[model samples]
Target: MGSLSRHWPRIAVTLIPLVFALLHATGALHLGVLQRLDDIIYDARLRATMPRTLDERIVIVDIDEKSLDEIGHWPWGRNRVAEMVDELFDRQQASVLGFDVVFAEADESSGLKRLRQLAQAELKDQPGFVERLNQMQASLDYDALLAKSLQKRPVVLGYYFTGETQAKGVLPAPVMRRSELQGRPIRFIGWSGYGANIEQLATQAPMAGFFNPVVDSDGVLRAIPLLSEYKGEYYEALSLAMYRLLVGLPEVAPGFPREKFFGSRSYGGLESVLLRHPKGTVAIPVDDKVSSLVPFRGAGGVSGGSYRYVSAADVIGRRLPPGSLKDKIILVGTTAQGLLDLRATPVGEAYPGVEAHANVISGLLDGKVLFRPDYAVGYDAVVLLLAGLTLAFTLPLLSATRAVLASAAVIAALVSLNVYLYSAEGLVLPLAAALVMCITAFALNMSYGYFVESRSKRELANLFGTYVPPELVDEMVKDPEAYSMKAANKELTVMFCDMRGFTKMSERMEPTQLQELLNAVFNRLTDIISSNRGTIDKYMGDCVMAFWGAPVDIPHHAPLAVKAAIEMAGAVRQINEEHRAKGIPEIGIGIGLNTGTMCVGDMGSENRRAYTVIGDAVNLGSRLEGLSKAYGVEIVASETTRKQAPDFAWQELDRVRVKGKEQAVAIYRPLAPAAGLERPLLDELKAWGAFLRAYRAQDWEQSDVLMLNLQRMNAKKYLYELYSERVASMRLLPFDPEWDGATNFETK
Candidate 1:
């Protein structure tokens, strides 16, 4: 509760960005940043996943520089173009021919009108000149010759529409009329002007399509309009027209999503274009703009090699093999750099504009067109709502490691699903919005946790900086609401260490020197305890109290306490050496450790609370610290501690009742880690065990003999000497069989 109360502002801050992103995705708000990001990601994905293989069905008849050098530069005379068309249809056997070039104006390059004027005016009296002009007139009319070649042929001429005011030349027969869609409220892109074929060619080849390419705001040609409106009539793109021609020129109609009968509503937005044939129907996908994404085959130009390119010069000269373009849809386009027909696309920066139309045509034929319908906005919104809110609320509750894993899992799943849809279903769904939302939500949440929530935690660390180990403080702050100062009973390992000769040593030193000495000693001892993961409870004069398994839980608190006790005893040796060199009396410390259930937490008046432990187990720890003198050892621990940490070598001290507890707890002095104990130490332990066993069995004679041998083995060992004297005194007294061999302590 405390942590939550303090850090709720950070949690709320993390959610604010998510809400704004949701609003933007759902169209309620217009922050345009996410949309731009989505556009870039979509472009990259499209480029990366393009099928780089060639499509053999469609071929490009390119008027490249090589062709230009061989057959003269572009805006070629109508007579030569007439020959090229005848060569492709007559010699190469192309099934269908479409021009990417526009022939809007009349072809007067042959200058046939000037000769006729001379025959009529200046050479009127010349009989041969007038007759020759009259005879050669039809042969000199190149436009008439080209029109004658286009007559009754499967040649689709290309033209262009503009946004300007006036419509120029003539347009082909309308594929769809405005009267058909009059009452449906269909929104079509309206164009004002157009550049169409000359009247002769338009009348001869009535089948034509506008070759106007729709470039995006970024100047990239990603989509081509399948249908556009001009002067109350609808015309098809070159790709759509060519596709219709290939499929037997089916009737094209506007398609909408299947919906239940609702009176007089716009059929939402254009979903697809339906082609109705006698045999069956084929639905070509398109977006609301009536545009379809250009499925790029590869990078650019000849390197893409999506379609076979044939030189116009070769075809015009009939230098190619027979049936080389047999039954193939041939599109006549220029790849000359000066033609300015190159366009920018997702796949390439300078992509040929004609190839962009070719890609769309091929995609429509194969049913591999990528569709991004109006409903994609709704899909993006749903993903943001589900994924964004999930991360926003849940990430703050997780640890740093867990939060990272969670974010990674979400991102991986989202990307995998998106890529799968792209590969399998041909759906160009909006991936950028969902992806950006997830990333931003996670980033914002993590930053808030670090900059905002962590500030409170750092403050908590400073508050308890000197009282506990830094690691403990860190763990406690992870869930500060659950950690309270209220008293609670927990199984903990507590330690109490008191300087044995500190009072006598301090009496001889001045107050200033004694203070310095005490500070140095406490500093060294406290470091040992903290380094071993124990929390210091308090310090009184020369005595220091510490514990483990509170503020943070250590499953093996007993072992940690025992390890700290050993290290502290070793530190005293170093302390004493320094003191002896400084001409001051050296002191020793006795440490006692007991592992059991005890009450631990902050306990005191409201103004002076201290985080400490209190219970019978704690009292026993203090009593054991005092008994270290009686055992002639520096450290003593209850049997419970020895049992929990069996990896350490322990020597039995005695079974005695302490000042507070009634149960006669057995105590032992921990020596060293059991792995490093010498064989002599093991043998001595065995002998001591035997002596204690006999002493408990009332075999005084056997016990006396064992004790004497143990005394000889360690003649200066006071613990053994004390036991020997006790055994002798016990022999003089009457023994009771009911005795449990427990010595009772009568004083504190």
Candidate 2:
């Protein structure tokens, strides 16, 4: 089951494309599916047009929700609509007007019929009779009045057709009728009769066409059926006929050059309609099947709004001004509830039916329409394969970061090419497919990277000794590349601090109390070290081994080490106070510091490893701690560490050779030399230093004179006894030529 589930994606890959091809080839493309494709195209194209700020020539007069409630239902009387037309042509001076609505019926109400009945003397008081007469006269079915109005100027009417058996409209003559269907009687369905105004309207304004929508499978209108054939006849759409008539071009077929059809000069399916503007005939490419792709510019039409709609109910009253219908072409239609013209579209859901026609006309005017040809499919297949294969092959070979960057690069490349084709060549490639493929490859690679790295992290962190610090586990994961189990020379200040006489203290306390007390002390000391940016190397029983400047850089390593030593001593004092309060024995701490090159890294055998500092410097630091008690101090450092930390006051102890090193080096006790008189104490130390040198040279008179004067000046002196004892011992040992001031201590 697991294997089948894993391979299910491949099975789907093989089946889906075959299904897509079958649907396309079988002529099952419907209004619903085509709409979905149109929506996808709209989503991408609209993103491209986001940056445009202004367009100058187009203007939109809104017929908003305000106008709808101001009026009642749609399809008002024709005389009032004629007034609106006069207003636009005469007052607004609009160069041309195209009607998005259709006039399938006519209005015939005139004021004279209602006026006659109300004037009779007897009927005035009879309320019921007067009401019936008003209703009768108010309903003057005037196809004649509207026809006379149409004669005043150019006007176009709109209509539509259905391919079903219940389709309406008389068959118009087919333009490209072939003799191949010879002797086969063709049946045509059409409108049996039209409330057509022939004398006044049709004679003056002769252009008319259908407005049937070519919907896709998703109920989206992506194209217009430019020409429909039935019973050896053809008819035009409403927008096409009006456009053809206004341009004064041949309506049967627009004269497009044959080369335009072969090359890039595209055209719609209808006859070549010369643009009324200076632009010559537009090439509209209708497939051999008599359908044309509607080149939709976008949702925003003239003045960035759709068509201007005047409510029919509002026009019936004098709501619109005079001269409303002067020279404009008025096509009238309905926009009432229950009329059911609303369609779901990308830009809007409640879009009026007539607005779709307006969008087409606007596209025609702006030349912003993007049409798809049958040839685009073949071109896109090659593009998708190239884009997909490139990412799939490259992703596995690169690191996670590089793979992400490459994926973005591929997406950007595909988008740039798509946009370039749109602007330069008027061709739109299938960009979404390539983007999907790039994302797929990137996702796969990153998922695999995470899976592989997760195991490595657990393995690497576990390799650290079981008792090692948990913090080291995280550092190993963040960068396993820089870490090496082998040691390397690193300059650091290593600290080895231990508690004095811990075994005696532990023996007196209970096991739980001892454990708890140790935890409390260690936790406090460790926190102090970390706060100073010192990496705790390891903990050995009650002792701590820490260092500065490893796995990360700490610039003031010497000062930090000195400060940590002081804080640990203070903590020991606090811990001893707590022990006294609890009636337990007190504990003291000793800290030693050394500065030199040390071997630092994760060190140990395969079973146990530690990130620590080790070398002669580490050994010296541990050795220095043993000498602290003899010097009557808590913190001590070798000469190298003392010199590095010049800010601290110190008392120089005698030169000492540690257990491991034969070379004798000076050591110092880290102590506050003078609380209020630093210069005085410093002067005394310098004089004592002079005296010590004299005594070493066997000049007893000068040594005795300098010590007596220092003692008299500094009465509370702490190092005075040490100097006196050193002088007494030197005199007793006598004057050997090999004598060096090397002192050895045995107590902690």
Candidate 3:
């Protein structure tokens, strides 16, 4: 709870971007840049995953430049169109044919209308002219010939819808009427004007569809409306019409969402268009706008190789073998540039508009059309919430490197899920908002941590950097509010180390040389103390003081302090070796460790304050350091420190009363780690223990015998020799029953 409270400001900063993302997702605020980025992402994904292989089921009979050159300009004579239609169905045996062009006016290229005017007025006086014209009428009437050729054929005529209010030509029967919806308002793409086939061709070919595609705000054609509204009647697109005709003309009905996930009145748009047949029902998914994303197979045009492009002149000229295109669905469209049929698509700019229809028809046949579900907005909101909150809460707690890695992982997951849905499930969900939200949240979090929260850490580092180790200072800065320099008593382990021979060395050596040697020695010793997690208190003349379990609570401070003292003794021995090689004076150090309650914090006069410790335990530790030289040992520790640190072996020094204290305390010299003690040392300590017992009991004869054995074990040992002298002197004194087994010292 404290950690959360400390980092709440950072969490709030990270959530700033999430609010904007949610607004953009829910339509409260629209971000045009995000939408444009989404379009670019969709385009790149489509191009990368498109099946760039040939589709043999459908073929495009392109009226190319070659055909236009061979047959003259566009809007060729209707007799020629009739001939082409006859060749496609009768000669080539194609199963279905769809025209991507509209015939809005009657064909007058054959001069039939001019001849009729002449026969009615100017040429009325001519006798054989009228009779000859009547006989040639059947062949000259190209519109009638073309209409007759289209009769009873499996042909789907294409038309276009416009936003203008002008309507022209005739429209085929709508696939669905508004009454069929039962008055439920469905928001369909509505158009006010249309250009359809002529009445003559409409009557011959009753099946027709509009070829209008749904253009995005960026002017890219990515989807086509399967059903649009005109005068309260719903019409189908060219692709949908062709697909229905292929499927035996199933009944079209609106498919509503099965689960009202957003409530009844939330959405009234059709979820899909159901093709109801006796066998079963085939549902084609649509977006809220009743549009499906065009599943482009590959690039368009002759060299694209997605669909076989046959020149119209080849079919009309009978240059190929008959029945070569037998049972193949053919789309009659012009690919000539002058015909103006190009459109900008996701896969390519200047894409042939006719090929767009062909791609849609191909997708419809394979049931692989992609769509944005009506719940896509809800999905976006949920994903943004999850990712945003995850980053907002987690990034503040993690380090900079970890935060970056976490954010990258989140983005990769979102992209992977989105791509899987697009490729495997044919779902086009919104991804831009979620992606932007994650990135922005991470950036905001990192910025806040670096700029705002770093101030507190810097202040903490400045306050504690000198007295504590860098690592401890780093740890304290994570929660700087929990620590302060106010004086407090704590159960701490205090250490006092004093140097020997400093006065003699300073008297003989130059002042600069003595200062350099002192600094070098202190530097090496202080490193060992800091490495062992000790906080340096202060440095007195020829002495250094330190303690543990302060500013940061450490449960094992006694063991750490004891270990540091041991290492510091070893460091002095090494320094003596260097002094011997340099022909300089050698030095010695004595360290004392005691564990007890002590006051530790910044304490001094108002002018100059120092973070130090002061209490009875601290004084006892200093007194123990002075006793190290008397006991002929490098390190001395109180009974309390030895009890707290059981990992090391100790040789009992003495129980003595110091100058300031009346109570006697037992002190021991740390030998080595208990596990590393040698057999010889162990036997010697056993013998020494027996000698102390006998000497304290006034057993003079037994003490002398044990002393001889201890002398033989280590003859040059100062401690055992000193005990032997004491035993010899005390032998003459009478034994006092009131005497306690402790030594007393009255001097400072």
TM-score of each: 0.59, 0.44, 0.60
lDDT of 2 by residue, 435-475 (tens): 54456556654554243277767776665534234565565
Worst 10 residues of 2 by lDDT: 267-276
Ranking by TM-score: 3, 1, 2
The local lDDT score (0 to 100) that residue 206 gets in candidate 2 is 61
Q: After superposition, how far is residue 304 of candidate 3 from its true place, in Å?
A: 1.0
Better of 1 and 2 by lDDT: 1
lDDT of each: 0.84, 0.60, 0.89
Estimate candidate 2's alpha-carbon lDDT, on a 0 to 1 scale. 0.60
Please write out the lDDT profile of model 3 over residues 1-748, one tens digit for every residue.
6777899999999899999999998999999998998888899999999999998999999989999999999988889889989999999999889999998989988788899999999999998999998999999998899999999999999899999998888998999988878777888999999999899999999999899998998889999999999999999999899989999999999988777453423667788999999999999999887898999989888888799999999988988699989999889888898998888898878888888889999998988888988878877888888889888888888989999999999999899999998889998888888888898898778877343277887899889889999989888877788999999999999999999999999999999998999999999999999999899999998899999999899989999998899899999999999999999899988888899999988889999998889999999998888888888889989999999988888888888898799888889988888986999999999998888788778898999999999899999999988888888888989997876768887764
Backbone-clash count (model 2): 47
What is the overall TM-score of model 2 with all chains considered together? 0.44
> Which ranges in model 2 have alpha carbons more than 4 Å from their true place?
1-38, 47-72, 82-99, 105-141, 166-204, 251-280, 285-338, 441-748
Question: What does candidate 3 score on TM?
Answer: 0.60
Top-scoring candidate (TM-score): 3
